[model samples]
Target: MAEIQVNEDEVQVGAETASVCPACQALLSDGTIQGKSVLYCTKCRGLLLPIANFLPLVEFLRTLRRPTGSDIQPRDNSDADRHFTCPQCGKSMTGHPYGGPGNVNIDTCESCSVIWLDRNELQRIVMAPDHYPVYSRYDSGGGLRRTN
Candidate 1:
């Protein structure tokens, strides 16, 4: 995997430019997840997803039925303690538990609005028992609405 130096001011990866993986520092190849463009690391198989694509991906995953007998579990808090730098912004990424049933901790860059998810984190979230109504809280016109 080719190592690339990412600029701190770079907010997004262009289709013509390459990126580096935040986890393994490997070359990040452009890829699609659930029809949304994302960056994938060949070495660690991790995914770097822009925050804009997050809600859509979750909504799509919600449409699928959970597989029977699946026993995936979220990583411990120690996993979140590991510091990660955003490949896009070159800033420290904050780690937090994903606001859903899986209890998966994800690294997020508030400045760049990007997220880093290790392998299988997406699967655990998709198979969560309850759906995450992130976009549903907003009205069709994009205004926030109260949910009972």
Candidate 2:
């Protein structure tokens, strides 16, 4: 687990990322990102699940700034094709679970519906070792709001 000092003020932990796809690393074809959105790949036009949510590009980009330019050591979570409803919007989601173990994992809203993180996901992320660029402002004290 890494630690990302977001914007100097708030330090959002465990938000590290590797270089995205080969061509346009940041945003995939129809706008996908780190284990988030299922966007149509530009070159292939196939439905590829991005790193996370295709919701907020700005936030994703902000959190992706790494000093080292080497590619990320890709993990073997390739079989994560199950669909779960977005806790905030009730829309079906496709992608990997964002955040680390201790911290709460957030089911990000599709197209920025609303970000909902489970209890441990946030803590695990903040407590990670490497740390990504995007930082979450110290907002939630008690975590996770189940709307359904």
Of the candidates shown, which would achieve the greatest TM-score relative to the real structure?
1
| Residue pairs in candidate 1 whose N, alpha carbon or C atoms collide under 3 angstroms | none
In TM-score terms, candidate 1 sits at 0.68
* lDDT digits (tens) for residues 5-73 of candidate 1: 432211223343257787888888776654567787766767788988977776676576455623334
The local distance difference test score of model 2 is 0.35
Show the lowest summed lDDT stretch of 10 residues, model 1: 7-16
lDDT against the true structure, each candidate: 0.68, 0.35
TM-score of each: 0.68, 0.27
Q: Which segments of model 2 are wrong by more than 4 Å?
A: 1-82, 97-106, 131-148
lDDT of 2 by residue, 1-148 (tens): 8843332212222322331322233322333334344433233222223233322432544365443332222233442453445432446654555644223233444563544332223323433435333433433543232222
Supply candidate 1's per-residue lDDT for 57. Answer: 76
- The prediction achieving the highest lDDT against the true structure is 1
